[model samples]
Target: MKKLMLFTVIVAISIATKAQQYYDVTKYGAKKDSSTLATKSIAAAIAAASKAGGGTVYFPAGKYLTGPIHLKSNITILIDAGAELHFSDNFDHYLPMVESRYEGVDVFSFSPLFYAYKAENIAIKGRGLINGHGKKWWDYALTFYKNQTARNKYQLLFDSANKNIVLPDDATQMQRGFLRPPFIQPLYCKNVLIEGITITNSPFWTVNPEFCENVTVTGVTINNPKSPNTDGINPSSCRYVHISDCHISVGDDCITIKSGKDVPGRTKAFPAENITITNCTMLSGHGGVVIGSEMSGDVKKVTISNCVFDGTDRGIRIKTTRGRGGVVEDIRVDNIVMKNIRDQAIVLDMEYSKTKPEPVSERTPKFRNIRFSNITAYTKKAMYINGLDEMPVSEISLHDVVFEAETGIVIRNVQDIELRHVRVNTKTGPAVSAEKSSRILIDALSTVKPLMDAPLIRLTDVKEALLTNHWLFDGSHKFADIKGAATSNILLHNNILKGATVTTAADVPTGTVQL
Candidate 1:
């Protein structure tokens, strides 16, 4: 009897393995023409494939207009090289709101174009197009936000407390007057793979994966510009993810790694960790690679390698503020190349004050353990490091960084920072600016052009700072270290000044050791 039971188990396993089935959406009565209701046909295809165990649902070379494609476990949606899966324009097609996560909150709301919840071993691989019809949605959101006057912005989320009540969800759905966030949102899935697809024109965020695990996204191209909040690839509150060989050009962040927001994110304690993004190109975005403002959970062990950014507003941005207390640590960015960056190349602000910046505390963000190496950037505004006076940045480092900029670098509110072999070629600006730091080490700083500010180096309101081996050829004391009042314990040793100076700030307290 036991042997028979074992045999039955084996048979069940075999049947589970046989779930691998295939469905051709175009062949299964889906409309090939652009103006057809392919929703039913496509859903039928997915349903059939899902029922038959799990297998690859294939699409041939044509434009198959579809709505949300809910994925299942062990299923793969493979599209042909010439095929295009254009998502539906009408939002109501994604009705019957399902459980999903947006900005870290788990709710029942709009479905994504390609969505998988609690599914495992699912993969979407093909050389095809996933066009997120996002123009109208984005226009609405941007216009509404811009025109929304004096209306209590915080009241939007406050009014959402009515959701917990057992009301008719369909009747109380959030009105679409532009409060929507993204078009493609995949939440709470596992072991997913998306490769070799071109996703474009997202009305909101193009691809969002929240509260998932072991996901791999590679060789994808995302292009969305005519919209606001059109973040290209945002993987929030997920674990063990790898993103590589992706090209992104969007209006917002190109590749943003985030956690959840505020109370829910903190209470859940689901931090986004063990993520790696490599070999990517970002062109024209508000931030090339960002981790931020809503990251109330811990964001750690993130590595961005061999990435290139061009015409981006900001390159490496880690922004957060008070009332969103989180820990951002162990972030390493290496081999980054940037060209014509408009804003700060590397910006870290604990006070990410859009409206009014607040303090840095447990209800605020704490940034530390950030390291960057082998970076070459041409920037307009140079580098920036901003933190609160209370809780500044810590354990920061930059090695082998060469930046040729029209502006320069600004450092503030930091501790235990180090720069090794950092070279700058600037038209006009300070090469390095340090303020309110403890234990700073600058080594091998070489600059080519002089600035009107006479800033081979600049320092103010700092303590426990070290300036060594400052190699300059202009033969001027251009490096100014203005230790302000209450600034003490500065050591300048073996420093070669081309065009730099040192001054004791009139506000400098007595008994300051300036060498």
Candidate 2:
């Protein structure tokens, strides 16, 4: 009986080994030359691999030009070293639009360059290059942006389609499409992995995985020219995402997290949560790691660490407007280094779009419980935090942060902020200027080369602020300037102010500042 059991186990192992197949594209009528269209041959190989209970569709050591490549479940696209898969620039090749979300709106648009819908255990791996030749697409997009006639045409077509008013058969996909498809999108996929691939010249958001779970993207290098909307990696409404060891240089934000936009996003209500990004380097992007201008379905529990940003517009940004009604909370960023940032190193603004003040409802976005630690930056501006009057940004904490900037920190309409061990070397303006805030704590806050005419800290309409342990440097002015009638409960204790006065405005009540 033991001998029979051993023989059965051996037979099972042999069968499983044999079933793990490798379907090479070259063997399936795919030419090695870059001129020939190899879409059909690649699809044939994928189909065969899927039919045989899944396998690795291999591209070995050559350049092959293709159109969109659709992936199925249990498939691994292993592009070997020296293999380059160059996607065609022709827009017509991405025909028969697939279900995709473009910039937070659900649209049946052009298929992404490599798309998978509702697939499981899918991966695109191996050390190779996948290039999206997107110059033509970018030119068309530029024309579409500049010409109002083209915009009106597409808008009418989109509105008509949404209203179920169909007429002309000659209406091309371009007329029906409103936004360009991303370079890589796996919609509603599970256990997805994209590793060891170098992608460049992407048409739109590169490495976008929408509504995916347990996604891991590592060792990927994305280099796109300064084109429109070429974001590096955007995991929209995904959960359990792990992104590390990525080098990104793109036209837009290096890494952006989103759930959805306005009403449609709120209706779906799938928050992007439990994401971790580490050991990434960003260069020449709009922002290093951005949260949203499109978060209506709340984003929470994101942690970013050990990242480096060079020549970006902003280092860490969480931005939303009034209509983008979302809650961004429980975010932690640590161990970051930034240089040559054009804008503020850190910003959390709720007024990204221009709108009048509305009632505090779902239309008012909220940002709370975000923390930053162990950060160093050299930038134009240090930090800016502006919250809505109706719903102020709250519970923000920063520790051990140093900034060398042209200007200083600005805070407006915030509450429950804690700044500990913070240093700002500013060329102009007060080291920290706060207004319309309450419940603030400043500990060990200092400046290098204090401005001669400006106070080290300025407060207006602020209440319940406790300024303690600040090592004030000597220049030419006051230590604290207090203003506004509503200012109350201001305490200054354990500070080396060096005989600088704490001045208050005339409207500020007597005994507002307690030393």
Candidate of highest TM-score: 2
TM-score for each model: 0.89, 0.94
Candidate 2: segments with Cα more than 4 A from true spot: 1-13, 145-176, 474-476
Model 1 alpha-carbon miss at residue 488, Å: 0.5
lDDT of 2 by residue, 1-515 (tens): 99999999999998887577789999998888887999999999999999988889999999999999999999999999999999998877887667888777667677899999999999999999999998788888778655654545445545554553222212353254566779999999999999999999998999999999999999999999999999999999999999999999999999999998887678778989999999999998999999998788889999999999999999999999987788999999999999999999999999997788889987679999999999999999999999998889999999999999999899999999999999988898888899999999989888868777888889999999999997776663678899999999999999888878788899998998899
- The lDDT for every candidate, in the order shown, is 0.78, 0.90
Question: What is the alpha-carbon lDDT of model 1 when measured against the actual structure?
Answer: 0.78
Best by lDDT: 2
Positional deviation of residue 508's Cα in model 2 after best superposition, in angstroms: 0.9
The positional error of residue 364 in candidate 1, measured at the CA in angstroms, is 2.4
lDDT of 1 by residue, 275-338 (tens): 9999999998999999987688789999999999999899999998766778999999999999
Residue runs of model 1 more than 4 Å from their true location after superposition:
1-21, 144-162, 165-178, 354-361, 498-500, 509-511
